[model samples]
Target chain A: MNVGLLDADVYGPSIPHLFGIKQKPDIADNNKINPILKAGVNLMSMGFLIDEGRPVIWRGPMLSKALFQMTYGVNWCFNDRELDILIIDTPPGTGDIHLTLATKYLIDGVIFVTTPQLLAVKDTIKSIEMFSELGIPIIGIVENMSYFLESTGLKKDVFGKNKTKLAELECLARIPLMESIAQAEYIDNSIFSLKDCFSELAFAVKTFIEN
Target chain B: MNVGLLDADVYGPSIPHLFGIKQKPDIADNNKINPILKAGVNLMSMGFLIDEGRPVIWRGPMLSKALFQMTYGVNWCFNDRELDILIIDTPPGTGDIHLTLATKYLIDGVIFVTTPQLLAVKDTIKSIEMFSELGIPIIGIVENMSYFLESTGLKKDVFGKNKTKLAELECLARIPLMESIAQAEYIDNSIFSLKDCFSELAFAVKTFIEN
Candidate 1:
């Protein structure tokens, strides 16, 4: 799949680390930058623009501009053909980054990631509500760190119950906390490693996209 | 102490839930919003402004305004005397909300809350970097959900090592996951309930502030 990922998380961009990219993207035509290609996906992040250890202490106005620049400023298309999918890694909250993206782009839907903790779940519900209010479609919810498996193979709900109205409201994927999954080694310049850790998740995502 | 709390987390204001305030704050003279007094501490939150179950779907600009209104627009003083201290409950991340507060206010210092997990620690590092760059002093770091205590009074580091250099960098307080702490009850508008959950934390904060 011709996938593209934009790390809209200007403050703490982790896409570069996730993709293991150190070199910056090249400047394409019209001062637009080309995204770094890894495996079968094109990735871009603000992490490439600034030095590591420097904080992006920008106010609201500045952040909005940067977010706009990152989205509309870059050259994300190729030869008049757009990417099959563009996944934006946004910071947690139901504010600026979300509102900006939802308003400025044609988002198909949004997937919410949350731990099973009540505090995290409560905030996520607010986030879901915000997205719905913005008229965005609820893609699904993924419960991360849902449970841990013991040596006896007994599944333990570490964070707490996945008892949320989210499952009733939409499709919910409960991703357990596995040591192997958490400690997955990324193969050199390959997406296979991610698939190993998220085989079930990838399958679910594929089903969602296909249907 | 004449303390004040502002729930700058407009999207999911949990101060109301945490403090268990059901009624709204009253509007004082010159359109200054009077904070709801609770156990000697004055509190204000967006949760008090809006109805339950509704989301604050505001853009960056609107959020800046709301944050400004919540901080400067409100009367955070008693009998013409300014509050001794005003604690702002910010959402996670170094995004618009953090930037807005950091830029607008002469914040003395910032306290970071994080789990011992690498993911949470990574984000907290970014937040710390942001605060440092903004010239906000690092008060200290509070490690929440640090451990799970067994029935036999054994403490297990479920998420693993408190591996961050935060202690070497700043004062660090590790808060254990205790049933008594979590299940602390809010009694008759008394903030003492929270003291049960955060007595050590409160003492650490007080020491940091005094120093």
Candidate 2:
């Protein structure tokens, strides 16, 4: 699949670090920024534009402008082949960036990620409600950090059990807390141990988008 | 100390849930909103103003406007006693709320909280630099969820080791991942198990402010 990943979290772009791509993108003849290709994915992020540890320090208008540039100013094509899908990773908030994306673009769906804790669940519900009100379909929720496996072969509810009933929204996956997933960037070529869970999630999302 | 907590995390106001306060603030005769008194602390948050589960759905301008109102329009005095300090719980990201607070207020210092993961540490450094550039003093860092204790009496680095060198700033505390802390709201009167860590943090902040 020809995939493009746009890291819209302007404040703290993690894509550059997560993908381990620090090289700046080049400008094409048409004046659109060319995304960096790595591991079969085309990627662009604010992290590539600034030095490490330098905050964007931008206001709402500037944030919206940056989002616009990232969305429309990037060439998501490679060798005359257009991207099949462009996944946008947004910052956690109901601010200008979200407003811009919701109003300006025709997003296929939004996947809400939340821990089992009430505080996190409450915030996730808020975002879900906002997107729903804006006529965006919520693909589903991903319950991350659901539990931890003890050495004695016991499952510990690290955060807590998933108690909140999410308005009948399907939970795509209940990903366990794993150090391997957290240190995926540090350990080079470390195969994700929980690939099965993620594959199931990807399949679910694909089915949702198709139908 | 007579304290006031301003939940500047307009997008996700967890203060209400954390503190277990649901009553809305009353408007004073002078048109200033009177903060809610809970456990002898004065509190104000956007959560109190909006219906539960409803997203703020505001743009940047509206965000800034609401922030201004919360800061200047709230009466932090209780029973003729003024608040000794106001701790603002800001949302993640180096955006308008942080900018507004840095530019408009006379902030003493900022205490950064991050897990031991590189991703979180990177973002924390961005925020630290932003506030430092804005001339706010560094009150050191709090490394929350540093480790989790297994039933086998072994400490697991769930996220990862604290690998990054965070300049010369002091690390106030290395708080463990405790289920008690996460479920503090749900289980009423459940005293925080890690009060010592927090007490030390409070002392450090106080000493820093005093000096």
Using TM-score as the measure, the top candidate is 2
Candidate 1 residue lDDT tens string, B34-85: 8888867888899999986676777666877888888888888845667888
For model 2, what is the error of residue A129's alpha carbon versus the real structure, in angstroms, after optimal superposition?
0.6
lDDT of model 1, residue A114 = 79
Q: Can you give the TM-score per candidate against the true fold?
A: 0.83, 0.96
Interface RMSD of 2: 1.2
**Which whole-number lDDT from 0 to 100 does residue B89 have in model 2?**
85
Q: lDDT per prediction?
A: 0.72, 0.83
TM-score of chain A of each: 0.85, 0.94
- Fraction of the native A-B contacts that model 2 recovers: 0.87
Write down the DockQ of candidate 1. 0.38
The digit string of per-residue lDDT tens for model 2 on A1-211 reads 7888999999888888888886889999999999898888899898877897788888899988998899899888845788888999998878898989999999999998888887888898889889999998888988888888877879988777864455457889888887777757642554456777889898998899789
